[model samples]
Target: MEETAGDHQACRERPAASHLSWAGDGPETRSGLALGHHRPGETPMSHHLRTLAVVGSACAISATLLSSAASAAPGSPGPARVDAAGDATALKRPAWTRLRAEHSKKCVEIPGWSKRQGVRADQWSCVKQANMQWALWLVQAPGAGGVRHHIYAIQNRNSGLCLTVDAKRNGSSVTQRQCRNKKYGDNYTKQLFWYTPDNRFFSQYAKGKCLDIAGASKRNRALTTVWKCSYAKNQRFKNIK
Candidate 1:
């Protein structure tokens, strides 16, 4: 049977809730230190000086606390402050790589290294070709341990277009299109994907859907498509070389 993007629509029930949009837990708002009220005998100049003195004292205290926190020995007790961007940065996939299907050993590529949009990506014999290399760029950052994993935009090295799905359901057209933002709202997540935490090689572009090879065929030029997210061999892929 010929393979197309819109092939396997309902492999399993899609989760009732999924975190498609993502963002970090940004820095907390802090209030400035308050100086005491005016004294009965205080002149304007004296009050100014007193205010400066209070500020200086507060700065010194802050400095001391900072020094202590910085110098705290290994295995210290207090909870270390967590940066909101840390989790997003940890999942960064900046390096370009050639994704090879686990079952066929062929790399995903844009046919003929075409630079046109709407070109369906396919699998070909692994090679040092420009179209085969892809980069997973973090498009949306997930909150610290938040639900919906971080989203990445997969771009073809040669065409520079992003991998986008025609629809959210399985077997929708998986083609290279101009990178679009999620805010644009016309089925925006068609281009957004995230690596499965349980399986390092599985990439899901939509809820319950993942990138897959048609019939796991070893033949060159085998079309790639989206299928229900699973542990299936055809759905698994890894970096070439």
Candidate 2:
């Protein structure tokens, strides 16, 4: 299909409810650590001093942990604590968890999956199929290869009345050839699913394409289609916890 934004028109669904518009505060107020507006007499020096204090405290804690870990043997509790730091960082971001919650809350459950054999299909009562249930995750293949080598398109198989099962897509992009089955088969509908947790923050997976913000609002009616992977930040969807 033609590449345009808003290609998700066919699947009926609400707008604001699915999308969170978080710009993460502008550059001037990016940190969001300040109290109310500053008083006229307060010197800029104070802010610098406070910032340095916070940084120093964090460094000191890190240094202490590192020093302890250095003294410990290879298989020691100290190493475990150091390792936890990495996991903790990932846990701090509730992206995927939020997405799952939203899917359960906003997505309408469609039943009738068994009839289509390997395929699945479902409709959401609250959110549009496109917004809630009709999307896929694009992941990087593990190994040394170009961007296309690691990119994959994964989506649930929809057949008959049931929606979603186990089916995945592996390729640089969408395939033009359609699969036909004498008994029952479906041509990829080319619908992308935007799994969002908190609204603005979302992780999207396309059957053969990636979501592009610049084109989203413009061509709203265009059907979903595959496009070159630009790896745009908008395409980087976060899964909400």
Candidate 3:
């Protein structure tokens, strides 16, 4: 009972009844209202209503698509991308600088022109010595909740030793120590310092303490230490490039 080739050709050639109704002969069809159903004497108000309905539907569809696109877009802000080699933000990377005491106008230096660790840091004349210059690097502290907190390590350009606190207690002397590039934990915690908007280096380990010139001394070779931050001139420092 297999159908012949001619029978198959005839079946393919025959159109379905639904297709015939869509050929401008019916009142309405699946595609839309048949053109033949619209009388020549149709009211102009009805035509305007139909046109408005189509425009409103298109507007609604466009609004929904725009809303979906906006909802699916990325929301979180991107991380700040700064060039390390450029002069964008100097504190964001390690840069050579001269630390000038606000009260004494002297630059920070290592004693006896030594680059060795355990040497006390002092303020001396603004000389062009390599030991007087520091390479400051900012390490981003952890637990930053949408706010940036930095720990700065100032290393002597001559000896490569980092400026550190002799002890973690208050009134500790600031000295040069072996550079410990740590962001957190017990190592180098006392050495980490944070710079404030008022141009003072605040000690991270010693709460409420800042890098201060001893006795507000204006004499050469005056020692630097950590004292209670009082917004005084002795506690302020300027990073001279």
RMSD of each: 20.3, 26.2, 18.3
- lDDT, model 2, position 2: 36
User: In candidate 3, what are the lDDT values of residues 14-132, reduced to their tens digit?
Assistant: 44222222245666556564533443676656655554554455445655665676677753211122221122223444557898988889988997878666888989988877889
**Of the pair 2 and 3, which is ahead by TM-score?**
3
The residue pairs found clashing in candidate 1 are 5-171, 5-172, 6-171, 6-172, 7-171
lDDT of 1 by residue, 1-241 (tens): 3322222221122232211111322232243322344446767677667666554554456555556765764541111211111233345446778887788878889999898878998999899878998877665556734736766667777877777777767676678877655445554466667766543332344667788887768899888888787777778778654
| Error of model 1, residue 133, in angstroms | 0.5
**Could you estimate the TM-score for every candidate?**
0.56, 0.22, 0.58
Deviation of model 1 at 177, angstroms? 0.1
What lDDT would candidate 2 get against the real structure? 0.29
Taken over the whole model, the C-alpha lDDT of each candidate is 0.63, 0.29, 0.68
Please report, as a residue range, the 10-residue window in candidate 1 with the lowest summed lDDT: 76-85
Q: For this target, which candidate reaches the highest lDDT against the unseen true structure? A: 3
